[model samples]
Target: MNLRDIDLNLLLVFDRMLAERRVSAVAQSLGLSQPAVSNALARLRRALGDELFLRTAQGMVPTPLAMQLAEPVAAAMSALHGALNQSTAFDPATSTRSFTLAMTDIGEVYFTPRLMERLNQVAPGIRISTVRNTAVNLRDEMEAGQVDIAIGLLPQLKAGFYQRRLFMQRYVCLFGKQHPLAAKSRLTLKDFASADHVLIQAAGTGHGQVDEQMAAQGIARKVRLVVPHFVAVGHILQSQPMIATVPEKLARALAEPFGLAVRAHPADLPQVAINAFWHARFHREPGNRWLRELLTETFAEG
Candidate 1:
């Protein structure tokens, strides 16, 4: 098919259909009649050489090709919207916009309160959505405009995305106040290895790395549980005999209130650096620049 012959507006309807998964909902979102949306979908299906969507009892389910095109199409629309909405003067006081952020549990716990406080002070009507940080393809998310910002220790990031170091944090061992380890001022590698542990593997880098680190020192910790987030680890340690190693900043935040004791890691473990990530496309955008500045300021204070 000739690119010049295709109408770009059909992509907008396709994106809405993907998001709402119902013709009526897509029509409502686009402020069009149901028949108008259906007509647009018909044009899109011919342009894309596929049915695009199948009517199921649940909703309008996307074909495999439609599913594959969803992210890029949505991202393009978002970028277009942002470009059209750009202004020389950004008055946060009157602007009502929602921003989506991808961050780890620790980041959400530490940075969100400060961010929300600042937003409320300046933009009372603004909204925010936070997505879980997973070991997924983030470069595509940023490039497509699905995620405005990503905050975490994304060591294996792809090229083209801009990164700024936000803060440096080390890991510390945490246990319940009433646990036996809490009685000790410090813990040795042997103490850490012998205890039942709760492992927080956010990046899906299984316990192999931790085990390898311990094995280098001829130590082995019995990993009784493997959780996806540090918050869950804290919950497990609250009443259990499980000891967990978590980022020092997060541990410090939860230590007192959770009645947990923190101790230094016996072995020389790697210190994690948290960073803010964004697409180069927004490197000069005024609103994006302002948001990045706010993020840096908030994290720097901690």
Candidate 2:
């Protein structure tokens, strides 16, 4: 029979009857009348094309099909009931659960410290595990429940996922105090293009939007080194003449202790907006809601 022809509630009655055996006992357990329980069983039998319950000396014997469906039906009912009973009031103080997040190194460096501090204040026992964002089956990993939240500059996300923009970042040029260009408050496009640059290619591509911007202006940078992380770029620029183009916030943080200088890009560089994403299945989940709220708040503070 087609699903439209059957009432899923009949499965719940059938599961309860199969557990309690007698129709009267099932009725009492579900707080329904005996006649209602009998009617439900009749409907279930007709739908399954089998007499799911055979009355015997032992009260009721379940058929093979009914027995096979018992565990799955019970599990589905339990999950449904739990979801319906979810609480909107999240208590982080007593929760000892761990959250798994997928993010790039740049996100980790900028956001994690504030998040951990908040977590310690509200949920001391809670832990966070971070997974590196790679260019592989991201949708499959999220759907499989391998990661709870994915945060990055996801330009092309597939359907069936929920996304929200956290914050936008602008590109800036960073140089050491000893560099020749450090004296200039504002860098010109010619100075940027002529300078030796350290490119932070997180996705293994030496070329990115900045490269495209330079190409549009009929200028190209002298790429002296290519690295994977902004942190690495920060460290490398400390003792070298290589100037790196990075997110403005990262450049500011690195410039503080590394004795580096930050300058705005002369060309109109495209802004990178970081987004927080999760599977649609978790759009209504309580724990997921708590985590996403905290993330938004933390990022806003930064």
Q: Highest lDDT: which candidate?
A: 2
How many Å off is the CA of 142 in candidate 2?
A: 1.3
Q: Mind giving the per-residue lDDT tens digits that candidate 2 earns over 179-251?
A: 8999999999889878999877777322267667768878788999987767686678888987888888778
TM-score, every prediction: 0.69, 0.71
Over 1-302, each residue of candidate 1 has an lDDT whose tens digit, in order, gives 67688788888888777657789987887899999999999988877789989999988888999878866675577678668767667667887877778887887888788899998897787788898657364555665457888888776553446788888777789999989988999998778878998877766422235546667877677989987667676677899998887778888888887889999988887766778888765666666777888788778535
Q: Report clash pairs, candidate 2.
A: none
Model 2 lDDT on a 0 to 1 scale: 0.78
After superposition on all C-alphas, the RMSD of every candidate to the true structure, in Å, is 5.4, 12.0
Poorest 10 consecutive residues of model 2 by lDDT?
Answer: 203-212
Q: What TM-score would you give candidate 2 relative to the actual structure?
A: 0.71
TM-score of 1: 0.69
Give residue 300's error in model 2 in angstroms: 2.9
| RMSD of candidate 1 to true structure, Å | 5.4
lDDT on C-alpha atoms for all candidate structures: 0.78, 0.78
